[model samples]
Target: MGFGHIPFDVSHALAGGMLLMSFVLLYQRRVPGLIAALATQGGLLGLAALWQGWAQGAAGLYLTGLIALVAKAVLIPWALSTLVRRLGMHGSVQTALGIGPSMIAGVGLAALALVVALPVAAGGSALAQEDLAVALSVVLLGMLVMIARRNAIGQVVGLMSMENGLILAAVGVQGLPLLIELSTAALLLVLALVAGVFLTGIRERFDSLDVAFLEDHRGERR
Candidate 1:
């Protein structure tokens, strides 16, 4: 009824894939590429949950996986793509930091995550500890993505990516209630829809999705 029943390598592989996708998100420049990377991360997250469910005999994790697949992997990405197309934002991403610098920062953040996670998870299983470390790194990287990007769509993608890390950490642990997981997923869906609507309004008003524009408008009003 625990990860002890499953091969550690399998869970590691799935979680590792999710961490790798976070790095990919850091490297992406174009809108379409960013959406694709997010979708791929969602898929990896679903697989990780599925393996965890099987390992822990938690049927709830399977449902979490399904939700992630359908909502995150398919629905959210499709919506984002449509939004990008309609808004004519099919261009390179604008970042506040260069790729090399961002990546170096990401690596430093990742190391910090490991350092923090190991001590915190000292009482937990090795698998859980590793998963938590990776999850922490993903969360930090996702935040970096949000802070580093100027595009509205890129920021939204980063927000969702951070949520993915939370889900990963939740599923990695045993005995966590399924209700919490479902609620978290539902909240994210609401967040995505709300963000999309908000972005549309912003674009219509200012004719630009750059947050800097909004700040400039506010400054002019003031």
Candidate 2:
């Protein structure tokens, strides 16, 4: 199955939805809203994977979709939400770059992604080129989210979102091995666990999840 076999419109719509969620993540200043956007993005990524499997006639991608739904959509969000409640951060406001400037930066990053990915994937099918471009945009936007946030949990969500973009790109590429897909899923799980531990430690040490506090502490020590 070739990339051209997949319907360009449908795949683009799903990828575009994920990209929209990335923007939502950036626009959110509340912790709960950020988590909800992350879950929504995950759901869209799962759908995109399932659609790709059907279009590309790849059974492996169905498993990839299932993994994405379970991990990204359900488990990760649930875990993060629970952790937030436990840490008494459910109502905490996330510190971030001003919404206007962040949005402008996001738009610029999206344009840069399209400019880079389109020419790099010029030899591929139109669907391939578009998906690659969108995936890169999602990745760059995720990085933007991380940079804009001062909350540790928000940074973790940004990291997971970046992984979602990688998975999106992998599913779009026909003939990607199942082993690679499985490994990527496993890596996300491990990352979540590690983030949880680190976040707990940070909270305990600083009495807040704001990373700026860590920087202040470091300066105090210095």
Q: What lDDT does each candidate get?
A: 0.90, 0.90
lDDT of 1 by residue, 1-222 (tens): 245545688888888898899999999999999999999999989888888788789998899989999998999999999999999887798888999999999999999999999999998878888889999999999999998899889899999999999999998888778778878988998999999998999999988888778877787653
The residue pairs in collision within model 1 are none
lDDT of 2 at 136: 95
The weakest ten consecutive residues by lDDT in model 1 span 1-10
Q: Which candidate achieves the best TM-score against the true structure?
A: 1
Give all TM-scores, in the order shown: 0.95, 0.94
Show the colliding residue pairs in model 2.
Answer: none
Cα lDDT, model 1, residue 193: 93
Cα deviation of 46, candidate 2, in Å = 0.7
Error of 1 at 160 (Å): 0.5
State the lDDT of candidate 2 residue by residue for 83-169, as single tens digits.
Answer: 998998866566568889999999999999999999999998888898999999999999999999989988998999998898899
What's the residue-level lDDT of 81 in candidate 2?
A: 93
